[model samples]
Target: MHLDPRLSFLSGPSVMAQLMRDKDWSDSAVGPPQEWPQALRSVVNLLLGSAFPMFVAWGPQLAQLYNDAYLEIMGAKHPGGLGRPLLENWAEIRQDVGPLAEQAMQGHSRYLENLPLRMRRGRGEGEEDTWFTFSYSPVQDESGAVAGMFCACIETTRTVLAERDLRARSEWLQTLFDQAPGFAAVLRGPEHVFAQVNEAYRNLVGGRDLIGRSVADALPEVVNQGFVGWLDAVYRTGEPFIGRAVPAVISRSTGEPPYEAFIDFMYQPLRDAAGRVDGIFVQGHDVTEQHRSREALRQADRQKDEFLATLAHELRNPLAPIRSATYLLRSPAAPAEARNRATEILARQVDHMARLLDDLMDISRITQRRLVLKRERLTVAAAVESALEAGRPLLEAKRHRLQTNVVDPDACLDADPLRLTQVLSNLLNNASKYTDPGGRIAVDARQSGDSIVFTVSDTGIGLSESAIRTMFTMFAQEQTALERSEGGLGIGLALAKGLVELHGGRISASSEGPGLGSRFVVELPAAPAPVAATAASPAAASAAARPRTVLLADDNSDAAEALAELLRLEGHVVHTAAHGLQAAEMAVALRPDVIVLDIGMPGLNGYEVAQRIRAQAWGAKPLLVAATGWGQEGDRQKATAAGFDRHLTKPFDPQRLVDLVGES
Candidate 1:
């Protein structure tokens, strides 16, 4: 019977019992069976011998072989292969084992390498080939003639194939690791030895061979940089470390500047299959360009701040005299023609100086992010009209026609009135300055959605695309040298933008390139308030009447004396104080009607003196008028909180000051 390959061998005792029964049957045969032919008895013996293993017996020659293991390997083939030629039954051994078989037949034992053989068990049974080690030994008959061969073998194909596949994958992985960029390296052990490094890492370390070397030994500089400590920590705890924009200086043997590098890197711990920490894997990229760019930007910002401070100091010095001279020239006793000419020169030059001062102040405030707004509800049309009124002189002098179109006369907005008017006036004045004689400039207002849109359109020299792009930037102007000489410091639009943003509004400019005129639009949110009429009060006319006693304190003697003279001319008794201590003394002795204090004085400033005066019990407290150059919102708050009753900036409107004192 045939057996499957998966079955186990039968026990030796069972096989022996079966063999004994077969021998008894042969011996107890009847007279006719005993008298059977010797050839048939020999056939039976051959079949029994073929049942033994460790013998390559086939084709009627199995009677010569003997071994139980061999019989088990060729189970059920015993009887069929008895006394048969081995080559006919096992065709696979014809090439290699054939020679061995022939050698065995010549009374020689043969040892063969792993060889292939095919075996058949019964008629019509398919054949199978298996790998094996074949050892052939001759089996001889009693006459010493050649009979058959015995063989032994083992299989080694599975182990060989598995080893070959592993080697190919290892080679491919090694190639990929060696070719990677950006300083890739594998470290091993707690010491972080350079177990493997890519070409990038080799180049970074000055072309030195680093494999199999400790990190500190291969690159001693890295140890000084604390990289060794970082690696050790990561390896010990199996944790990762990531650093960005780390600055380093690389030294080279070649005569060159020590190159600076900003590095972004990661140190990751490597682990084995059992999850034990083995090494650290490092990867890094250089960010030198980004570092340089940030440094350049910082330098530029510092330079801009320095320029603004210097400009403010230098520009303010000239402005004070120009303003004082203008005030002196506005007297009524001068000749009509000479007075008119002086007034024109005074207005024009004063406007020019004012624009310069405003630019410097605006730049300082915006850069420091201290610009504050005092918002109030006002009509858009009223704001536009106020701006036009302020710019009327310039428009008339330029002979430009001013047109107004108010589609939404009742559109009110919350904004700083003075600052809002300044924004509109700047736009109108710019329009008038750039437009030719007889050209028309139009101011229009309308409500668009929740916003009130105010547009100032001018038939003026238009802006180039490049100029328009940078027009709202400080010190950016579209005007040529000749046009600039006519007037402008190119900061109006920048100031306008800051002021508009302070009021939660927006300003924009549009033009069809140069020579096609331009339009500036401002959109502000609407509010709920009636537009007040623009009428000057007759009370503003009651000037030139000063208090009975006026205490003037200023560190600048020229300013103090000049102001004292003006106060005296206004019929006030004037007392002067040069500093805070002097002003306090004078306040006690003079008991003046009003104490005009100057801030920014050496030692005790105006605020301190005002506090002292208000706290004193020797005399009646005078009306305190702050008349200093500090005009920021914080300055106003400080003045008020310090017990001053009125606040006025330096080079202020003389008429307004006279009126304030007269009222007091």
Candidate 2:
């Protein structure tokens, strides 16, 4: 056989040296020893020249490797077993070795003396009971990651059998305690002295010598954390106490601060043969990562709930104003001037509501990863101009001073014009709303590095550190959400973050503490100018069309009555129903020209009502429209499938509804 390639690197080798020169190892799982890495080669040389019985089960599959002494222990399996997988040869005793090797691969080392394994050795009667004193340690690759296991084992069957009855029972129990996985220690008497401790338990106390030490002496830091008290209770009561994910601060290694850890632990009372409690057994497992992940999910769930409540309050805020304006216009005795002013108020509130709905849809699309930008080549001035137009009214209303600085107004950049403007607009509006009235605001843009940079600075109420950190997080203040005197579901900044990221950009917020003002910066990648398209002429607004009789169904009395009043002012004869079943009855009897249904109602739901109404044998069917608060895409699809000709989410433009019904 050809000499192993790695043998040349060794200064001197013994048994494996001859085997490398004579054996054909080409078909082994580890391949030829010649092709092995320097590290593996070094380890093989140590095993070969050493007097100890050492073996290596390396690589992902734990391929077998051994020295001459280990080969002697395997007897008949040695000659052809050089590089086979470890589990294949030890299949009969796999239950005992599988987990040991897997744990070793994870960088844990285990030691066991007189451990039992059922194995079929040469001419063994059935499965023979074998005992060995073994140590399994992790073998590190050149990169220092655990590659597999390095085992040093000694067959102790003869020694163990000779002293089986002569050995003290306590020694056997102690052996079992050390072999157990996880952190383990046996305490003696009420003082809970650490009579015996495993390497795992010793490591838990920062590698301090824990053997023969009392619980209080070895881990005084944990005393204040109630561990000592729990131990005392278990000792006195003689009852096992189990705690799951218990928070603790312990020094795991020397020179490191006491890091927070969670543990699932149990303290069981150990009894002597006399049946009296003699000691306590402490066993624990670290669960910090799992606990942290679960807590993060719970916090997110709480935030979402808070946002939902805030959403409901914000939706109702504008509805109240629109409702009051409708009442004023619906009165026949109202002056013509009052009616005109009410009409203006109603239109403004409807527009505000529509914008809110649009924001919700935009944020939803961004979150679901469904938003796609229509990129175009344009100057930063165009985006700035559009954003300024959107924010002007708010600035005017607040009487805030506004300043603008465009480093190069004509400098071209590639971007999605509408979406880019939206990101800036949300920042401006956030500044305008959060700042005290008559405060200062500034907007700027420039080419910085390979990025197009912009900043929106505000002199309103400055942000606190906590607020700044979570300001761009969705539903950050969702819990306790109902009241938004400042208005909105707090979605603007979160949506802005998503949009900025989509454009291969980033956004950040900073403040000089509360009352000192805040600044938000946005940066987008710079790109070369592209061919510009000819601007299309803006279409003229459609003229108001004729109206017809309309029927509105909703469980919300305030919303239903207000909407009905608004339709009447639009010259439509309006009827309102407060329940789905009632609306279905009315639709069959009156057969209004248009039927608007709410999805959620007492008795039957809106979907069922629409379905039932369409099934009616009417001379002429009315136009079916879903006008409820359920505004998801799925809701729209379901509404269409239920025979509705049109779908409109709540707070939709009143004029749009009139036009839709007018067409029929």
- lDDT, residue 149, model 1: 48
**What tens-digit string does per-residue lDDT give for candidate 1 at 1-664?**
5432222121133443244233323322221223423433343344334443344452233333334444544456664443345665455446755676667767798665544455444434676544455566654444555545455544433544465568878777778777765778899988888888888777665777678889878777667676888888898778899988887666543555566678888999889999998988899877778877887677557545744664565466556666655665777676677666666666556555655665667666876778777788888778878998988988999888888999988788888898899899988988888888899999999989889898999988887887777677765555442253345555678888888877788999999977889999998888877657676567654533434688999999988898788877888888888888898888888888789999888778999989988888743357899998787768889999999999886667666666767777
Clashes of 1: 16
lDDT of each: 0.70, 0.82
Pairing residues by index, what is the TM-score of model 2? 0.56
- Whole-structure CA lDDT of model 2: 0.82
lDDT tens string, model 2, 1-664?
Answer: 4534456643354665676556687676677766787678778777877778998997887888888788667766666666778898788888999999988999999999999887775554577887999999998878988876889999998888778855766677777767777789889988899887887777666788776888788887898998899989988888899999999899876678888889899999999899888899889877788898898788778778877887888779888888988899889999999999998887787787788788888788788876768888888788789999998998999899999999967666778898998899988987887677878899999888788888999986676776777778886642222222367767888888999999999999898976788899999987776566865333312223556778999999898888788788878889999998899888878889899888988899999998898787872378899988777777778998898998887777766787787676
Which number leads on lDDT?
Answer: 2
- Candidate 2: stretches off by over 4 Å: 1-159, 162-182, 188-218, 252-257, 272-278, 460-469, 478-485, 533-664
Best by TM-score: 2
Which window of ten consecutive residues has the lowest lDDT sum in model 1? Answer: 3-12
Q: What TM-score should be assigned to candidate 1?
A: 0.53
